[model samples]
Target: MNRLGVQLGSLPWLVLVTGLCITGLWSHQQRSYRQLEHERVERDLAGAISQALTSRLQSTIGVLDAVVGLFDASSAVTRAEFHEFYMALNRRGDTLKGIQGIGYAAVVPNNNVEAFQQQVRASGQPDFTVKPAGTRALTTAILFLQPNDWRNQRALGFDMYSEITRRDAMQLAASTGEPTLSGPVRLLQENSIRPQVGALIYQAIYGQPDRAFNSGQDRRNRLRGWAYSPLRMDDLINGALATINNPALIGTSVLVYDSDRTKPNNLLFDNLNLAGSNKLTHPTWLDVTIANRTWVIGIQLDHRSLNPQGWSNALLLQALLGASLSVLASVITRQLISNHQAVRLALSKEQEVSKERALAGTVFDSSPLAIVVTDPNGVIVQVNQAFCQLTGYSELEAQGNKTNLLRSGRHDSNFYEQMWAAILNKGYWTGEIWNRHRNGQIIRHELSITAVLDPQKNVSNFVGLLRDVSERYAQQEQMRFLATHDQLTGLANRTLLIEELTRSLALARRQRHGVGLLFLDLNNFKPVNDRYGHSTGDALLTAVGQRLLSSVRESDTLCRQGGDEFVLLVPDAPELKQLVAMAHKLVQLLEQPFNELANGAGSIQVSASIGVARWPDHAHDADSLIEAADTAMYQAKHQGGDAIATASSNATL
Candidate 1:
């Protein structure tokens, strides 16, 4: 009996060991599967990003080819002709993706410098003269840059041959007869206020019309000029990233390096937040080939943003359940072996198992994710409390209904057909989807749908898990608005104004309509600010913005051109008299006293000096129109205050 008792006790220990071994192996396999799955997902994401970046670069290079074609078709292209070509193909077209500007650079000899300057001066830019104007055997001077706004204007007349980086790229393109990308460098157009890493792509234009660039000697003898475009590295990278569908990439770190070198000096763009030694997770490096040049792109995943969906939680729950079952089995075996009178106690063990199953059900019902279960026929069978709370539907109302009942109508029938196809083919589908709540409000949710199968491999049920993400989308849109508008006045900022002006000018040119521009400068504003403080000045600016907004037509655009400066663009202003009357009205309105709310019982009177310029009359382009208006505004200021001035008719546009 003693030997039998020892064997009986050893049986329980043996069973416990076997259970532990089985659970441990299963857990290991689960972890390994997750790791492998993660790696595959990472690789797929990397390839998608690489393809996007490559496509943008190729498209940008194609724009350079179009620029080359323009020069090839003409023996000598004027600034206006080049500007028109740029507008037709770039500004008015969709080919210029993230390119700063398409510009023309003419190669002039030392003896021809005076003649070149004279030629440029006659081409509408009276101040057109080459910069870094040292005497050289040959110099490549920027002759024209299209969509000539304040930023592009800074690069006009800049001598590219003066800089070795630009010179090297120009020489390479001339010799190869291909688009050559420059190494990382700071653009001449950038100032201390807005510093950005810049690069240039140059396509060579040969002097001999029919000669091919076969050798270095041939290139040197025939090199006439270069058609190039400047690239802000951040703009190019962001443009590429914008095409990606990965939401996890928003906070991910990206680093681009020149020539496969990862050093700081070779760094072209870095989007990482490296403050306080913040390290990246799962960093990867890839070689991106663009126009025969290799750029090393480093991508780092934000592990915190990674989705822990599907099998992870289920694996954990399974492990916990297996371990509990093993413990319960061991206890029951030991109790039964000890005494025959423990039959009731053994039944209690079964009760405990039932209680554990109930605990799992409780966890499912209490989960944060909105989970809904539907039968094989696509009828809702059950839903968790979270689902009820999120969809504003009671369990009683939701049960027996179809998933289509939650459709927001934002998606069409085709979208649903494609979604069902994917789920049927792959057993699961996850994406950002729109659904409607019972309150009739549309909600954006990150949703995952899984199909469960029975022992016969037939569909048993469909389970959906969702988390609301509408607030996140709204916040992203708000951030975009804040980036382009003034916080104080809620009017468009300089960047937005430039874009609007470009679009409006392009439209006017197409329609053969006139565009009127007005530049307004407030008078006696600094004195009021000096006496009452900046709060009063801010109040005055906001009030002025409101008044200006009310005075303009709904189609017109009013922009805060910084500080006390304001600019207005009026479309289809066929008559200058209308512009003059509008300017006078604005001046009269500003001449009224402003009640300072910041200072109780305080009032300050201010006036505005308005300058007006019209397109196809005072100016030929957006840049020229703005310059004319600015020049006239100074004239108005000189003539005292609260006056209106038109651009000089005698001045060349």
Candidate 2:
């Protein structure tokens, strides 16, 4: 074989080509990592801005809680009393930082509007009336506003219940008995020349504020009024960014849109217009829910936010790294023998890894057992072909769905909790579970679940292997049936007969009730089997079993105790007369001709000789009971058959 060092060192074109390929690969990897880092930075920036907004809204809402508590402390809050409380709350630093003002609106009914207006006028203000002067069934007028400056004074006595946006928030607050946020609206404090968009959070105050009402209807019925705080969007957004987690969002434009992010009319705030950005900003949006109102907060970050050293430095570094790698490869090519061996070894290892990966994929797809892979959260991420066949869901349908899609409703939540507990604790759980098929059939599965862990020993994914055990389970059930029943006649065999008799005897003894046993043997049956073959004889026994079954009560146990011999057990029997009556009924039933089984065999005839015995009278235990009944059967056989005889048959029935 020729050495690659002898071949490549003699060729300069080969050296240059190798260097170019190496540089291209290095550049591609650097670019890929750069893109990944950019996406990570975008997510981090979005999260930081969302946190700042939420922190400010939550902090401001807390101030309204103190105001609502004032009503809980006093059944009636006078205007002077509300003023004093607001002053005291404001002294607690930064409590009212972003809030425009704190106010209370009184819920007034139309019938009592005059009385409410007179009461408010008498309290302090003489010129108080519900405005803008339209007759409505209910009106919520701004009654008590704190820091009653010229801006807030315009809202006093204004009926907030008349406006659609404010009324929606007030109604929601009253019904839920919780804080509800309103959509964007022009505040009465702003003028048309430079109006600012504003929103409010309303907390409902019910009649008995401490009591937990049953439903929304109950809350609405007991509603007293609402304590609210209004906010100007520009001041609130900027103040939030300044106070909470500063420097992380510095030089970033914060814009908020109401309900929808795409509509320009819904834009609540744009700090870029205030700060004058020279270039268009790209925004990363996060939907923030404030007391049920949705606000889409978008933070537009500069290119420097994506990478710490900036994109220009990142591209320069990529060029530097690629050039360095190419130069080093050229130097190493001079010692071509060692480098060639190393490259060949790396190629061999990579080929082996690729083959292993392909083999694993083939095994997973070809296995008859259904396989599914899920994330740690139990959401299915991958499913093999067998899984689709079993579940009736395609690969596209199964992906992104939770594992509970195939839940049969047979197992409760506790069953799954224990299954997952075992898997997490011991790394695997194997058991039989019931799952529903796509055709709405319940299928039994022999399920084995394994928790796949990463190098750090944290659970990364869950692998589930399901083997359909439906056919195996059905065969098992058939075997179980054969264990306790006579196959020819479908009657209880000796095993089941003994079990039922033992249980019945124990129950009868406890209740002081009588237990009856009737041992019956077919008479004159040997000639028919000899003449018509065993098939006909077996058919006749089945017919006899059906007749005996019809004559017995539901609580009675009838057993075919091998060949022409049968036993009937009756618990809670009243007396010996009942046993004698039942025996007479069976004797007459078997006496009827089996004309249906004639088959030109000249008609078969049969009769039954029954022997009756009662527990606690003839014998106390099961074995002795059977013996006593057997002896009575011999007596009936000797007495020419076709007659009912008992241990006490000497007496008249």
Candidate 3:
């Protein structure tokens, strides 16, 4: 009786052991399967994001290229040209914000003698009533045919001989003879009311016979006026943002900065912060440099917002299948208990564990998330294929090496110290990191590191998971650019200018230094717009923006304060004379005739006014400084458009 009882106990014990083994194998298999599914999903998500961003960038580049081509073809720079160019752009009208305006600057005959002779011989008077080339309305200014009246339009006849800013831009263009994009600048004419102007500039090539001049001393080949176009905040930039495909998936923000003082705080564009679930939020930003402008584009998405229901359903279905399979196997084992039970059960559990491990390994290796395991010393013990792909290294090359092999050199030792400290304290750390690939290319990565503890609660190993974030960085850069830069001329927009001005004010107050502000209004830009159209106006604006950028010191700020007005912020000026000199230089540059085509025909002309104000001496704060400059600018305009006026003497506070 005792032996029979002992035998029963042993049988039950054996059965219990076999069940435990089978259950362990089943759990391992399920975990492996789930991990594989997660990895595949992550890879698909990463690929989708990359494709979306690439498409957006490519589209933007294409549009810019088309705009440049249009600027090169015409000299008239009119509305008709703008319409034609817009049609050529091929972007849907609802999608486009309209081709604004174009203009250019060039050298023309300055001889009053020749002008009078031509006027006497010609029909009554060459019609100087400038009208928008294609449209009857939107007239802005008139031109006089009389020789004396032509004085304002003279290129060489005037004393703009010493203007520095204009001369510099022209010189730069003449020397390089290549199309150059200028930093953001405010339009001079729009100084009175509007607070910003953005323009795009193109250098004119003038060797054509139609642009030939009679005087050997004529410097016609010198810097020609720029082909320019202006951009409005709600129009070009905002419109572009609204068109972003899957805006829910890709949250974007832009920041534009101007290295100037007079007009400092310019916020170009920002479309960040959206509400949604399942979105991957990308807080990382990247810098994109174009010409002299630097823009930051930031992107974010909520991972939870992206089809969470689908993932949940998949998980539920997987669990249900796993449970059903486990139950069926358990029942089968019980039924076959008497026939080869020991061998079948043992093999089944072992096979299941092996299959689970294989599945898990395969999933991990093919995952988009880079996975790496290291011993306590930080020497890599194992790396997945994704890790190899991210670092541009092969599995064989990465194993047994240190994680530092992929260091990009962008971060200092202190950075690593902080990272390690966080991981040690919290057991895990998550952040963005800069790393290098095998090809020496710097790459951004979203990284999570965990400290694996042993039975004694001592750190035994480290595991790191990384996802390449280069695309997200690029998107962030694009956002920053849209926010602070003028889309038209690529100058610092009003928002950026204000920020610079505020900073300049703080610096000036601390150093007790003087800052100067110059307000500019194009003397006859309106006539150019009316006669030639927006296309010509745009070309002119682009050229003007370039000229403004060239005229200032590297320390100064040039901004588009809207319409035909522009502002210059000169920090740490020694005296008012320096300010006057800059103002005069700007005036002189504008005095040069803008050579442009009319209805695809040969060249036409334009000019501008300048106003100067000094900080503390003229007024206080950004607003007052701007006001003083505006008052002086109008005074200069009243005295005759092609001149400069100082705020201290011209306006009463």
Candidate 4:
């Protein structure tokens, strides 16, 4: 047969083969695309649900924090005081949707139960008596519940420590000094006829003596009471779902279980009223940590809502179109196979190049570091998403502008010159630089610049990348300050004091000015430490330091020279009379007794013996000046404490 006749004879078989290929490809692509769409939808829905749940819990916790603050500010939070606080907070428009009421539970000893009950009865609850009124070593009684209604009134006088569920969570709160959540439990407010599952969140409050809540032991020793709130599970779930009530959540159900052991016995709340819906085909479980306890929230989606209805119809239409085109394609292939082969190949190559360019564009836009591409003349031609985000300038605004628009003036012209020189000589430069944002804020950036070259070894363009390093730089400076400062007193340590003294001496020499130095030693401080404790001694020292600092001139430097010793440097002094007057004022201030409440101890009495020295007169160097001041200080102590003496005018010390 001739060539055209042979092609015509094989046309039917070619159409069958082409139809099979189209069916297979279309089936695979449609399945993959549907799967991706389902995953994206599920991810978005789950994220929304999680955020709502987190916000709901956080709001309730905020109310509990305010209640704790009230207890901290008062010596004893009376029922009337708590009621007033509750009414004020309610009027502030800060309402927790799922919270039943916020309350306080006082930690009472067994011996004090009768007194506590008498006090509660005196506070307007005539019939109030402790529940489970048996003698225990320690008891926690709910003394006050806000809103003062019948539902919340039932919780008052109930000892939460008598029940294992509440007691466990209270102990955890007391130990951790953080809010804690109880497992599934029935609240006292719920009636036997129509009971609701509930939980409690508790936070411990300590007295003033407990300054360091460092560990569980410390918390246990110092805990005075608990501030807590009650939660109804159904109300909590409803509040969480209120914001996300849409088609995606229709017919869906949610269940929360305690501690990941999801069973009927452990169920905290269940929104699904139907039995069969509990056995979901695809269920997602997310774990949330609230108040130091884990809660597993199960999201069972409605499978019927996810049906691929329109996609199925579209796939059928696509198959019909594919089969019809197969026959047309077979006929066209036989007539133009040789003539159009090169053209089709060329078109395929062009499509592949376009795809490559698109992939590169996606990567460029998605990069985390700020990226800018400039023409050979350093004018910005292109910018990425991160660059726009960093500088607060859109791509349209930044395209025609040079990078010099970001100069903060913190770097001089020579700095830019050096940067460009490095880029030109080595083809790359990397360092820290200051840049200005569009909002007029100066920011620190770790920047890198590279010279892009053409194939002929000629410069074509430049690429720059920047990352914000402002926070890191601030942290470094903070660390440096801490290293040179005393942690206890926040005064200059030995390292910094020596540096300042050296600088001061050098300046005084050039100006031909006199420097006066004084050495101060606290008297009778050891007796205070021995009678009270080191804490009391430390407080006394702190008080004396503050007094000295306030009494001195702004130019003077008062350095804590280790244990109970202090040195004051007075520069630009022309005579000794001013230094003597300052020494007497400081001694008199130190003579005053510190209050017990303010110092956290009994009243303390202390005095200071001060010695004075003149630079280049009694001493030429820092060490000689210090030695002269020390000898004079001992002379003052010998005469009597709280006296000031100057360096001898003798030949030597």
Candidate 5:
């Protein structure tokens, strides 16, 4: 009986020992699986965040590229033309803060400064002012040449070039032939409002005829002028923070810096700088370069602020699962425990594998943004449903094809080469691109592409994400029309006309060619408006705009400078005779009777006094060219309405 009792006791003890050993093995395996799962999650999270950041950067680059392309291609960019662009910027301002002003620079002749200054002063502001380059100077002024209520006449003569900092920045931009970012410098224009650095991105122009250089001179040899846009650092930091996916994790600290040493010591941007905080072992920094401007985006997430509940819940679940397994092991003897344990082990391993596969599948299938996978030669390999929706194409149709199936033909082979070069060197490329939809309509999309490298370090696949920007483009175009064009006549407004003239003048100087500027004032426009009411006057103006559009060559520009004043720019004219003949023909066209009217009052006859100025002959630069033609127009008007006058006889209006 004693031997039997001992045998029963040993059986339970032996079962307990076997149960504990099984539990230990299961726990060890579970831990290993969990660790692997955690690593995988971390990697996915990193990749997602990186992709988001890349998309944001690409969108910003696209906007900048559009602006640059417009500046490079168009003869003149008016406030109206920029209206759509400005609105687009404003709409996306949350994504890109800090952008302040966009402007162009034209060489003004030293000789014409006085006349220009007088005109500006007459218009209620100083004509010009100079600031010494590289100094800390803060002063703001406004000038105007036309009567407009919203005009900032105070900024007219403010010598921005005199400021040492602005000068240094401009010089740097000219030297680099690339957009250069300056350290935070105080903006005199916004001084009383808030301390802001003027981030200036400038493009150089050469051979302005208004300067000492003649048409034969190489303007490109010397920097003639520059176009610049200012960015505020504080605003940029705020914008970046707004774009962060996990805003809650952003905490209260952020810092932005320019990594370039040649630039100043100003922080690129700063929100709540926690430079001395103990929670931060090292600053988390992200380097972004767009349009040749480099910025170091830094973020600091406070450890204490992170929610501990997530980790706690995960631990609790782990413990519960372990306990459940142990209980099951204890209930079974060695035979049952071994069998059950084998089943449980297999199930756990299967679950872990399944979870990994699900994670990868979720990443591939559930992303909100469109993703396209292409093989090394730019042939499409696979595309997610998001891509299908974006491109209006099915998976089967896109697969096994070159990306050119969606090419809008808006960009040339050179453009593609440049894109490839960037990607090859940096492993990533981003920009705004126009691609054709399956239905053959052009679609503008902001795109981000990343090169996936194989173990051999060669690019094996490329993943691209695209966001449709057609609406944004439309909005921008609308804004531009509103700002630079006359609503009544649909012709170039004074601002736009002047910009065009200046651009043409520069071109004339470059080509050693002549340009004609014609200033025309309707002879009996006031009488007609007074007699026919304002509505009729508007109709007449619209008719006049149409006539002018139809009468001129494609290279010519016609504009209304308010009231009955009109200016025309004819480029590459050989002599003043051609301009005079065109002006005479225009006058005759206007003098002819018009039958279309709301009143239906038979017909109306109109005539105009015309003034002509020739580039390199009557005037040298934009201001002088306009002034001379304007003066001549007055002379023509003084000589009884229907006539023409040259700048040789400077008659004031």
Candidate 6:
């Protein structure tokens, strides 16, 4: 009964539960490993596909770079010269796999369009004209597209800049002098029967090839044409994947979208028709940014390896093995517990008697009262936990010492003599006494002593109990302080102000001197509080109170009259002139920015409108003096604040 005797009866329950937990944990770890391995595969396969697609698209930009270079080195490139250069580069065609073809467009000014057409016709294409072009401000005419295929011939003479998508890309290329990609578009060469989403990469070729262009504006000023390659999105993604040597993607389907969102219109390529399929599990998504365009690539790995059914038989076997172990463990534990039952019952009865004695000893040591027991001659014998705490002495330190070891020296010999006299005469003593703690602090205690007597009525030992009362006395003082002061500012409140004023006035009347009162109202304080929350406002008010304290005499009483208003009572003033000068000084100090609140509150600037009044000069008593000063403070506020207004005529200082 002392400690439930370890409840050896739960041996069976403990073993059974532990075995089951081990079984469940083992199964969980296996599944988690399988899941994690599958996710790793998905991530790697998807990442590789995305990287290959991005690399392939980036590779196609090199063809456009080659066209830009040809124009850069030449004074002029005729249609035949451009065709010859492009043919030499495209002979192998492996690097430019996804590009339909590369071409150059000529920039034609609207004012000189007719002249440009005539010049182009004169150069060999006598029938060439800018197609669908009429009074365009400017045009990039596709003058030469090769390998001169039927699709290439159809686009020649078309104004590429007339289209918004192409114009935006060409404009970007011209201004930035970088290869740029167009957003999703349909190429002009695409047939109606098999139209596909398309994009274009463009590189600007400036007319003043030998002239170095320093800025975008300068580049635009000398812009000649563009070297561009049109793209078929489906072919582009396929070409990118074909370049990847990673064999992990053998059973995977790669789908590429124009951007990150997976929508029908944005879908560029779906290799295995996986876009509309729901059977794919754990699809991995990747984003590839290529030439200022973003494409989202999704890869789905074969889920056959992830089929949990493949391991169902293994898990079933594990469950049966766990059940067998649990049954064997329970059977063995039951026999062991039964064998120990008789021996444990005997030990429990023997433990009960020893525990009772220990319990009694524990209660004595743990008592809240500082208890001490000593022989009739007063040699120390024992002390409790409370005694150690109250006097800062451990039981080991106090056991062999006399009771006088605690005497604080605050009481004279007569105090101890009286305490002993009462104890010996009446066999008891009770009184408040002072003792010195081990740490050299004086502690007050309410002490009581009684003599324990034998059958013959002779004293055998004395028992003393004491309770520490120092905290109770200190708390009384704290309560008094709280009642008379503002807790936040630690300044005297209105109650203390009245008391101090009454006493100061009586002295002033006998001494024939004046007392000054300044009532201050912080200008627009509500707005400040509203602007920066109450906590900051409270901090500002406390700072103001301390600032006023720093500039005042120690005898002066400063009080927070409530809100942002405060009152300072100067007991003995030199004159009305000095008092007003003090008021102005306070105003100046307050107007300076508060550095304490600068970290979060910014530069906080506060000003005070102070109303100054004097004893017998403004009014007779404390309340009347405060009222007169408050009225003058309002007058100061009306005069735009940050100034002093006194009750004395005009009241300006």
The best-first sequence of candidates by TM-score reads 1, 3, 5, 4, 2, 6
lDDT of 1 by residue, 1-653 (tens): 99998999898788788887899789888877776665565666667777987787677788778877887787878777876676566434346645677787888754488888898788788888888877887777888786565557668888888898888888778778888888888997665544779999888887765765567887777777888888888767766766677765666677778884546677887766441244744556778777657788766655544422324666777787777777767866777777675674867578677867887687779787999999977899999999999999999999999988999999988888988899899999999999999999999999999999999988899999999999778856764676567766999876677787788889999998888999999988777766776666677789999988988889888998766889998877768878888888898888777664435656778898888999878987776788788778878887886878888542221
TM-scores for candidates 1 onward, in order: 0.62, 0.47, 0.51, 0.47, 0.49, 0.45
The C-alpha stretches of model 3 lying farther than 4 A from their native spots are 1-305, 312-363, 412-414, 510-512, 530-532, 571-574, 589-606, 651-653
List model 5 lDDT by residue over 358-385, tens digit each: 6556566866578999999999999988
How many clashes show up per model?
0, 0, 123, 0, 28, 0
Candidate 4 stretches greater than 4 Å from native: 2-7, 192-194, 274-279, 308-653
TM accuracy, model 1: 0.62
The alpha-carbon deviation from the true structure for residue 253 of candidate 1, after best TM-score superposition, in angstroms, is 2.2
lDDT of 1: 0.78
lDDT of 6 by residue, 536-638 (tens): 6778899999999999999899998666889999999668778899999999999988887875647788888998999889889876777788778878888
Better of 4 and 5 by TM-score: 5
Displacement of residue 481 (Cα, Å) in model 6 is 96
lDDT of 2: 0.78
Q: After superposition, how far is residue 462 of candidate 5 from its true place, in Å?
A: 1.2
Candidate 4 lowest-lDDT run of ten: 304-313
Candidate 1 positional error at 511, Å: 24
RMSD of 2: 33.6
Model 3 agreement with the true structure over 1-653: per-residue lDDT tens digits: 78975765466446655665665666566557655544444444434433443344334434544544554565434434544555334324222223333333323323233443354236333433222232211111211111111112322121111233333433444445444434454433232333443533334334442454555334343323333333443344444553444444353323233333123343443334232322323333344443333444334334433332234434444544455445545544553443477876776677667756875776577666899999999999999988887888988898899999989889999999999999989999999999998999999999999999999999999999998878878977776677777866888876677788888988999999988888888777766766766666767787888977987789998988666778888877668877787677777776665564445555655566778888889888876787788778878888874778889888311
